[model samples]
Target: MERLLINIKISVNEKIYLKDPESSDLGKRILKHSIELIHSIGFECFNFKKLGKEIGSNESSIYRYFENKHKLLLYLTSWYWGWLEYKLVFSTNGISNPKNQLIKAIEIICDVIREDSRFSHINEVKLSKILIAEYSKSYLTKEVDDENKEGYFSIYKRLIIRIKEMIGQVNPKYQYPASLASSIVEGALHQHFLREHFPLITDCSDTKTTTSFYSDLVLKTIQK
Candidate 1:
């Protein structure tokens, strides 16, 4: 699994960018510094000019990869989903029990992220924070319908589908596996945000508690 993840090349939709960021060193530097900029300032405030200054490049260089900050956000978030799906596969490999696999999947999405040295340029921890604070913006825009048509969200949707399949295996009679699966992922992010800003709204104050809350929530919802 580690070998697979290290070698995994997650393909992003061509429509999202003018050029592939993984295709060259400059492009990879753009991703590396862009992650730092977004993690420091935020998605709303991050722009190509700022990123260019941070990476010691011109705005045109950044534009060579992404058309706009929105597309860049899409790329980053899409990459994260693909990486997460990889982790999900790795975490659940050879686990025949569907319930156990489902539990592990929940934990992967809900728990604190550990930095993977394999992706040295991409900080999993910072990316996870961006996901918690900014993932919705990637899809909440008016262009989402058109982007969806172009498979911009294929990786994310695929992850949800994988977990939805596990839910079906656990509870063959459960009629809302898709909805339940999506809820688990989105709810985990929301719960994380609440834990940080509105602690009283959620029971997730730390990694262990957050993992327990989500794991129990999914098990009870599907297994009941």
Candidate 2:
């Protein structure tokens, strides 16, 4: 039965790490608690020293995995996109219709997130909240070009490319598949932020309604 079972792992790029956190127990603890700490306190106030204290380890020990808190943010955001791509693939697999696949993709991206035990160290639900509130900070920096060169945002770009390709299949004449795909993803993130902080700005009163609006938006835009 062990051989019949499968394990899912979200791989972050090697250049983002000094040491692979998934390779060791201490590393996993650092990652798990770092997510908790950052989500609880917000990234601007989060640091290795604080993370170390929460994980019952030294700041130097945490440094073994990530160079700085910003890199840690990159790793977290990278891991999220990687995992989301996996979900997109799994969720839409074997579907014959491009429109249906696109609808599934939109629902997957827009719906409220849930934690998966397959990644024991990561809480995807909390990570989704982080993505809505803090994902921009991952790349909005002076070193963005440098980090892009290292492929830090490659997973996110690939996710867009996948969705964009689906858009092309549904509407081969559409001139802005890339732009539309990115807008959908970013718009969903913004809506999530607004729903949480300023509910009046969004049409969604709940996740179900929120998901419906995105589903309708994708279908309407592409069919137009």
lDDT of 1 by residue, 134-198 (tens): 99999998888998999999999999999999999999999999998899889888988998889
- Give the top-scoring candidate (TM-score): 1
Query: What residue runs in model 1 are displaced by over 4 Å at the alpha carbon?
Result: none
Regions of model 2 farther than 4 Å from truth: 1-5
**Candidate 2 accuracy as TM-score:** 0.96
lDDT of 1: 0.89
In model 1, the clashing pairs are none
What are the lDDT scores of the predictions, listed in order?
0.89, 0.88
What is the lDDT, from 0 to 100, of the residue 67 in candidate 2?
93
- Tens digits of per-residue lDDT, candidate 2, 93-211, equal 87889989998998888788998777889999998898998999999999999989988899999999999999999999998999999988888899888888998888886645666
